[model samples]
Target chain A: MRWINVLPGVLVTFALLLPAPAAAKTELYSALGEEAGISRLMETFLLEIAADERIVEHFIDTDIERLHRLLTEQICELVGGPCVYSGEDMVTVHTGMGISHAEFNALVENLMTAMDAEGIPVGAQNQLLALLAEMHPEVVKL
Target chain B: MHTNKFVGVALAGLALAVVQPVYADQGRFIATGAATTIDGAGGGGIVPWATLSSYAEEGQWGATASLTEVNVDDFALSVSAASLTFDNRFEFSIARQRFDLSTIGGELEQDIIGVKTRLYGDLIYGDLPQISAGIQYKKNRRFDLPSAVGAVDDSGLDYYVSAAKAWLDGPFHRTWLANVTLRATRANQTGLLGFGGDQNDDYKLMTEAAVGMFINRHWAVGMEYKQKPNNLSFADEQHWRDYFVAYFPTKSVALVAAYADLGSIAGLDAQEGIYVSLQATF
Candidate 1:
């Protein structure tokens, strides 16, 4: 192949990399409805998780109410809400849990469903997911 | 020969559809399969995307079937394809294309066998873009017309590498994805005129790209562009482009519509018209 013929292709690719139209600031706190919305989201999310057969076994022995509180606080803080996360670090909590990527993905799916039910926009939901995805290494020990 | 090839591919597709077991635990979110490309790969209407075909999970099986139609001003192209993906890592596909030459008074057909593999990266999880490499083997069914027009060979191959990235909620407050591909091909008029013409027998590097913004979880609007090589001196081959909308009412079905410009083909100018495609995944 002639290397010169590839010049146009290279140029076009760089052009596509330029900035696109602007979007609104993705403030996680605003997207998740701050404190009240986070609380409701956690409630709905827990219900969905409890109903799911795949990951429900993990929560069987755990305290439901405490789990809700910790989740609300963790999500709130992660998304820039005023609430502080008082839950234990992810590694300490999930170390012996032997969580797999499939189980984690399932839980995330349930979370997405709960957010959808609460009328959270897809973009905001993805924003929240992006933040949570960072904890995959710590949460999926197995 | 062409009929036999088509039958073989169709039978293979049907067999995979029947044998493959569908699973709910497949990774990658819903509606992320994009649309089936004309070449039977997972992508937009015209261009192959970095996304894998729908279905399949780690250590599991998945399959897809699609029909696509492209109507230009003077001609029409229809494609039927089936693909099977393994473990969300490797994909094998076969597609048959029929070119109805309304103005030229004869039809041309071709069969394509393709394979694609996810090399590395993730569309959403990692900072790096998801990358994939693919190849397509193409054979034209009719050789008389192409041979008379100075085609050197009836069969050819295309090799490509693609990179894709998806932004969930970055600067754009909406979900968006972008993909870029570089292909080396000797196909003329995308193999309608056969491969390796008298003017250019060597494969040329070309570019293809797609960018999409999700209006919602089920609907997205996007554009795709694919550059072509002008191997046949009989006519000028220009870049292909389209503006499209894709909708997924459910995970198993996707519909895509586009207005596309295929440029000039066999001296016919302004081959701009409508394109529509339907895909079913399992």
Candidate 2:
């Protein structure tokens, strides 16, 4: 009752200012094509990362096949897919890895480019990036 | 004409421009709460939000400098400001404004010093809105006419609390940001006409809001509305609103343009015009 007078103002402003809300028809996982689609996305992402000179040296000792499999599983689970992530947590896997801020940003840039090339929607791509952003503390050693 | 204050701000900004920033934690997303408001706060064109001025993450220092010009139908106002944010938590700012009443053939000037601190929540990472509290201390330099026209004082302080929330890719694959603020103030015409008046002297609670959407990583479009307190009886004061577009070509530089409606100032009705600002941060 106390908010009745102001409610109309708020509603009208929100309606006029915001874009129309998107329908909730698809989960984030489904938007990225579930497991099979994730695999292809990971393939493109990994290939681009390999070619990136800024972060390539850090991956010299990494196991590419294992890394790819774990990435696919991790992403699949993170995005509401059914896959289970059996890989080590970000901190355990990345501690002492000497990851710098520039390297991390470069990695994200490569990931974004790969997503664009793979036809991933901008929303899905940003969602994925948001989830990954939480892992920065664990991944960045410096 | 207070040309020295303008030159001082410009020189300080130039000095800051030459210092190379050393980033600590590359925290926060790109283009997150990156625009600077006309009042030297982090936000949209007209209203201040709860976000920090720039992309500086926790434990990092960020500084921003901006110059803004607003040309209304009967007047022209220019603001020069600079702000320093520390650890994405505390913000300190100083701004000088020169208002030229072209129609009246006179000018009014004011200096504002402000401090803001984040109290709780995060703008992007959590369910709760980011909240901040701030105080702006304003002093009018040219107030002889304002005092004669029923203004009670030439100096006043404004206190405000703001909340900002960001939803990433929540709708239409675009990031949306919404902010609300409650300010307690006695300033008339946002302090250009000084504080308090013959009709009313008590501080009034005012509401302001800003809603925006990120067009992409480097561009944003938004609208803002700020309520004002009508303290002076000589001329009825009105709320302010603007539709704005902000572009960030690089992480350090941002440009904003808007169409602002300042309602009534002094006695001029429908003071509508163009607003443009340039800001650089590191």
Candidate 3:
């Protein structure tokens, strides 16, 4: 009887030593494409921003295709993907635009609309906005 | 069309009667529990009490009424107020406050109108507090008093900046919230408009600080202390102070009970009383 009790304890100890279940990796960018099944959402978002009347003038001298690529690269990096943005720093890019606080806020609203149109989740939008908010002081004159 | 116009006029009058002197803004409802204290002093200044309702939504409206009493020497002062707020960010309020300088055996009263605007910060921000700036205009009603004290001016203006911060550690948080206010006004009179006289009508700065703790979701308690400069010559100008406990069942309704000690008026010790108020918002 004493030997049988010892065998159960030994089996329980072995089970406790097994490795834990693996954590699911975050699928940020992949969610927009694989999970949401929208491969062109990013492109559409960029186009909508470019077409917005309130902020489009700032991009007059920009090359659309080049700008699109830069934005895609930035978004990919932001979403934990393997892409490095080659665009200018925020201050350098926005310095000449002379953006007012109101105009900047309007642009932010338009960007949010575009993100929603592309079916970005509220949590994802908030994360993206938090990253962008750091540039408010540099982008807005007042 | 005539009947519609008549009805519109009647409604406008009713609106004026029901409105709190302050107004609200668009896309945002005024955050409840954000009213300045009595005498247009806010936070811990002179009066530590606050309104029950938050600001109204853009198209919504709100109203408030209050009664305040101060006693010093032979003088007893009482103030009654009605205010309205519209657009959620702008506010207008009117009040009638009276002074019964008992020792002098006369009555003095004034009418006050005020407007305020939220300049920066949001109520929901955990890191930042809500802030607002406002201006108040006071017009004195005609009265006869001893000429040696000086004449009462019919009008004067006061300006202020106020801020409120709430802690989010839930009801059990030891210190749940606080507010600070700074106001600059001409020392004209004490009760409603200006009580001291024209000679004392120079701009004086007043400051208040307040702290609050929540006992439960619908109940909280707070204390405030206010400081003011001595500008009157008739008597040692008393600085106003008070402590209050409030009940808030919802964002739209609040009741406050307080103990006030307004140091002295006209060189008499007039420093203790019980105060009560009820505020409603929509």
TM-score of each: 0.87, 0.80, 0.54
List residue ranges in candidate 1 displaced over 4 A: A1-27, A96-100, B1-25
Clashes of each: 0, 0, 35
The candidates' DockQ values read: 0.29, 0.24, 0.02
| Model 3 Cα lDDT, one tens digit per residue, B192-223 | 42434544656678775566665543566666
Cα lDDT of model 1 by residue, B45-160, tens digit: 87898788885545666778888888788988889999998877898989999998888899999999999998998766666788999999999999888888888999999999
Order the candidate numbers by TM-score, best to worst: 1, 2, 3
Docking class of 1: acceptable
* Residue B195 C-alpha lDDT in model 1: 95
Per-residue lDDT, model 1, residue B231, is 83
User: Any idea how many clashes model 3 has?
Assistant: 35
Q: Give the candidate number with the greatest TM-score.
A: 1
By DockQ: ranked, best first: 1, 2, 3
Give the CAPRI class of candidate 2. Answer: acceptable
Candidate 2 lDDT over residue span A105-130, tens digit each:
66887787788888988778877877
Best by DockQ: 1
